[model samples]
Target: MEWLQPTSENLIEGYDEPQGKLDIDRVESKQITTNTIISDFFVMLNCLGERTVSQLPAPDDKVYHRIMEEIAPYFERILIIKINNQIIEVSLQHVKKEALTILNNKAVHPVLDEFFHGEADKSGYNLFGQVPNRSVYKVLPHFIDPLEDPEVQQLFDFLKEMCSVTKDFGFILKPWLLSDELKQLQAIRFAAHYCQDVYLWVDNDTERIFEIQFKF
Candidate 1:
C-alpha cells in the first residue's frame, strides 16, 4: 500500500498524542472484517502519537521511490510462518544485520512491534529530532485511499485526529500493511533504509498476534 501523504499536491484532500490509546480485543475469524482493520489502524496511529514519532513529510517522487528501492533488498529472511509460530520470543533476527547497524535499533523497532505484536512501546525512547513544533511534520494526511463506507471514513477521521494531538513529525518507516495479502514482514523493512527516528504502520490482518519482548 502506498503511504500517500494527505497533501493537496497529491490529491489535496485529507488527512496524535502521548496518551493512553484505545485497545480492542481480537475476535477470531479466518476472514477479517473492515471494522477489525479499522481498529488495528487506530491503535497504530495512537501508538505513533503516544511517543516522539517520525514520518516522511510527504516526500517528493524521487526521494520516496529511491528510499523504497533501497529498502527493497533488506528483507531476505524466509519466515516459515508455521515454523516461526512456535517461537516464543520475536527478535530483529529477521531483519538484516547491516540495516540494523546502519539505521540502528531506534528507527526499526516500532514498525516491528506493529507487524508482530500488533502494539507499540508506550514507554520507549523519547529522543525526538530537531523538528519545530507545529511544523509540516505534524500534519499527517491519510495514507490509504478514501474508503466507500461512511462509518469507515469516520473512523479514519478519528485516526487523523489522533496524530494531530501528538509530537509526530514526518520520520516514520512505512510498512504496506493495507491488506493481509501484502508481505507485511518484508514490507516493514522499509524502516531499515532511513537512519533516523521514524514511526509508521497501517491496518493489520490480525494474524493471531503474539507477545512481544522489549529489548530496552
Candidate 2:
C-alpha cells in the first residue's frame, strides 16, 4: 500500500517491501478504475438533472454503484456549478450543448440557456400545455426539493436576478396543488417556468419529470 501511495503522483519507485509486487498491469488497472470513477462523477455533474444508467461505462461496477449511492441522495435535478467568475450551464443535453457552443464563442451569462421538458398527454394533464385552454397545470412540490442544494439554490437566485435585470431571460412563477393519489394526499406546488423561452414546459400530472419529453 505504501508503494501504491507514490503511484498517485505517477512516480512509482519502491520495490523493497514484500507487499510491493510492482505489477504494472495491476497498477494500470487501478489507475483506469480510479479515472473511470472520476470521469463518471464529472459526467453526473454535467448531466444537470437527467441521469440514466446508460451514461456509465460500467453501470454494474460495485465501486461506481457505491459512489453513486453515497452521492445520489444529494443529487439535484440540474447541475449548476460555479467555474471561476462564471457559472457553467451544463444540464439537459441541449442546454449543455448550447453552453458548449457559447464557450466556443467565448461568451457567457448569469443564467444558462433555459431548458425544460414538458408536454401534454391524452391523460388530460397539461404539462407545459400547448393548448391555450390548458396553459397552466399542477407541479409536484418535492420537485423543488432539489433546489435546496446550495449550488442549485445559488443558480436559482442568479436566475431570478437575471429575470429582473434582462428582458431576454423571462420566467413565470406559478403555484398549484400537488397530489399523491396513491397516498391520498396533496401539497402546494411552486416553481418557475423557464421552458417557455425554449419552447417547452413541465407537466404536472407525472411524478417522473425526466420521462416526459421536452418540445424541441
> What local distance difference test score does each model get?
0.28, 0.26
For each candidate in turn, the TM-score is 0.19, 0.23
Give the alpha carbon lDDT tens digit for every residue of 156-183 in model 1. Answer: 3332332332323232322222333332
User: Which candidate has the highest lDDT of all?
Assistant: 1
Question: Deviation in angstroms for 164 in model 1?
Answer: 21
lDDT of 1 at 64: 30
Cα lDDT tens digits, model 2, 1-216, are 010011112112332322322221101111122212223333333443333222211112443343334322222333322333233222212123433343446422212221221122223443333432222232333333222234334343333433332322222212122223311211111122322222112233343222211110
Residue 161 in candidate 2, Cα distance off native in Å: 1.2
In model 2, which runs have C-alpha deviations exceeding 4 angstroms? 1-129, 135-147, 165-216
* Alpha carbon deviation, residue 87, candidate 2 (Å): 20
